[model samples]
Target: MSQKSFHVAVVGATGAVGQQMLNTLSEKNFPIGKLSLLASKRSAGQVITFNGESHTIQEATPEAFEGVDLALFSAGGSVSKQLAHEAVKRGAIVVDNTSAFRMDPNVPLVVPEVNEQDLLKHNGIIANPNCSTIQMVVALQPLHEKYSLKKVIVSTYQAVSGAGAKAVEELKEQSKAVLNDEPFEASIMPCASDKKHYQIAFNAVPQIDKFEENGYTFEELKMMNETKKIMHLQNLEIAATCVRLPVETGHSESLYAEFENGNPSVHEIREVLKSAPGVTLQDQPEEQIYPMPALAAGLPDVFVGRIRKDLDRDNAYHMWVVSDNLLKGAAYNSVQIAESLIKLNLL
Candidate 1:
């Protein structure tokens, strides 16, 4: 609530990540002279409370951006593709939380801790990196700075919430059905609109998004490509395998990285990550302490642990990373970009 507040709008305000965005804005006390909540036609007129005030949701349309200074979008790739440009055209800065324009070559894929400076190059819109990518890059930025990165291999245990609110409900309902030995139906998982859906309770699905000709799912490719882009290492060799777990909120990853320079000691890497911004070092093998999705739920910082050098390669190391997919991955990161814009005088 500053004197120089701006008009702000949260598109898709009724969805999970969208609700989180509104909560984040209120928690951070983001300067807002006016607040607009927008959603699809079906959700229009729904009521949402923020700062103890109720605001009716409006239908998201091109004209909704009029007089808005900042727009946070989490509707979907298709919705973003349709309205983000319209928002930008109305002089509103858009921080898109979808893959709509992530690799557009013009839009900056940003994780503030990793490549905030890239925000200066953004043209009206900034793309938030994948949830898994965001946490990984946050934990890796300091390491990559001290020891140049050569390659990365990541396997992610992602949460069902990343798919959306309905997916989380599906997980709960399916879990109960299985426990009770009752029949249950699954029609929204792995990829909701894909050719088929699979059970996400008491099971792990290897596919996250649609598969490409190269045999990699789109989610895996997003992590691989987004890491290189955010780290500004265009030629960085990276591979990712993304899987959906039964967890409700946090996403976890097992990361193996090779450095260009000789391998740094495990202690050295620990010391660096302990001091890295937005990263919490939780490695303590002897005491059985490490990052877990349950422990990381509702937290903002990326948790890193299980540090050890690769068995055969002297220049390679592996670690575990965990974070709340909805916060740092989607909502918090978008708000952070708006803060960066103000701090960097770009707004």
Candidate 2:
């Protein structure tokens, strides 16, 4: 680690992902000489304390970019699209946590363990993939490298927290209301502003984000599309079905993959996953052990378990993966990118 620190600015510091970014930065002891928190005018002047010091949030504008060496942005797409360039023009490198620039060819959609080298090629901004996509790629990247992943099909049971702080509170309130026989309203679970809102308490909603022209929800499409981009596999076959579940935190996935060469034994797969970067293998079928959302909450690394060979598919395997969607999926990954930038001298 470099003894010299950098000036860091965190945009959208009032939002969920942005708050996690700050926590991750402090916990990881990121090299910070100065810290700036930027948010909308609505949140400007609000104070956030860290390391026993208080820093006030400022309105995010072009002028706020002055003297900023690195900027982490998690505001909505509109805000990111509006101010990310301004931050860059003011000589700050941005790691954006919105979908605004993920698909832009010039901007690298990065997950450090998957593609740390991508940061070196960034044109001032790096896009962080969706939460679902980040954890999936981290687990899959190692397998993709070893087994030559021919295809990936994943179904995610995501937690309410992925929808932000509001949706989390909504779930808690709806649950209490349901338990007390009180009629609760649903206005935020599956696409907050969509025509219809459903109760997420004690229920599963199969839609996340809005449906796209291809009948896939935007969240699902992000996993499918962003995986290919970050992995640098233009021809990788991927499908995703992202769902919002009633869980408070963490995201779990059922994954099926077809390998190119041979059917690796269950033991081999476990060992490979154990050695993979940013992954923890928890498969122990005899003792009824596997990855689960409850155990994964607040953890930084992706958890993989239930490794087995597909019955009919000679080269296919099945597994379950879990992680704290807010940590490795969003905040920790962004912080890791900044670390990579420092290690590789990209910043």
Candidate 3:
């Protein structure tokens, strides 16, 4: 018997993460009976190649989801908020790669390695966690399962690509200008819509998104809140400090966690992570082997290293985690949720 296939539509097909979604789907050989590439009015009529065939992009509208069985969304929060339900109403299951629906009590925020079972409770829409949050939780889940988590504090070295393609271009332009001693105006880093933009080249910005009234930037809050939602640890003591780096891909984090139940040694924790799903253990201080954003770029697995026990607290530990921001962090994760839906017969 032939395997089942679905009509797959990729929203925001012209953007970076959206392009990554198409690449992942083709690379994974997903059973796609028909494909629809969608974007905004400005990006419509653009041609893209997929599965060795040239496809034209169309304007995304409620009516475009007429026969779509599965829709992967990565446009932006506003686009997802406007079109996700329309796609769902047209009988499509949406795996949204935006923050619009992540905190919705009805929509399940999913990281397959951590809380795939939540997919069973999804109501037409499944939200992918923030890029930084996804990598941290993938590393933390095994530890939490073994020792139970109490507190988590993460400091992120995020890639400029997290901002968008335009931000990435701005970084490159700024870097060249600085090298030539030329003056360049800042416009996209930190937050494009904000009043002030900072130079991202040869500098680190301690903000990722717009600052909230409580002083935490929106990106930091996403990491803190989304981790709790996905892990089902609503009361989990969590805090985040998000920083934008000059790198073009991959997100790196310094994680400090305190566990509740057991007193596991460093070797035991290393062994646990070594066998954990969707994780690659690279903790080898002797050879200076550790996870790095450069090494993790383009990979789907979360890379963990520099695991050690805290001197003051037996239940506390420190580690480093890294993964491609656009892959495991967004596109690959969204596709994995769709695959989980099929495997569990929930689609």
Q: Highest TM-score: which candidate?
A: 3
* Candidate 2 vs. true structure, TM-score: 0.98
| Cα distance off (Å), candidate 2, residue 51 | 0.8
Cα lDDT of model 1 by residue, 1-347, tens digit: 53578899999999999989998999999988999999999999999999999999999999989999999999999999999999999999999999999999999999888889999998999999888899999988899899999999999999999999999999999999999999999989989979999999999999998999999999999998888889999999999999999999999999999999867899999999999989999999999999999999888889999999999999999999999999998899999989898889887
TM-score of each: 0.98, 0.98, 0.99
What residue pairs clash in candidate 1, if any at all?
none
Candidate achieving higher lDDT, 2 or 3: 3
Instruction: Please give the lDDT score at residue 259 for candidate 3.
Output: 97
Q: Flag regions of model 3 displaced more than 4 Å.
A: none
Question: Cα deviation in Å at residue 221, candidate 3?
Answer: 1.0
Q: What C-alpha lDDT values do all the predictions have?
A: 0.93, 0.91, 0.94
| Steric collisions counted per model | 0, 0, 0
Candidate 2 per-residue lDDT over residues 201-268, each given as its tens digit? 99989999999998999998999999999999889889999888999999999999998977788888
Between the candidate structures 1 and 3, which one is better when assessed by TM-score? 3
Ten residues in sequence with the least summed lDDT for candidate 1: 1-10
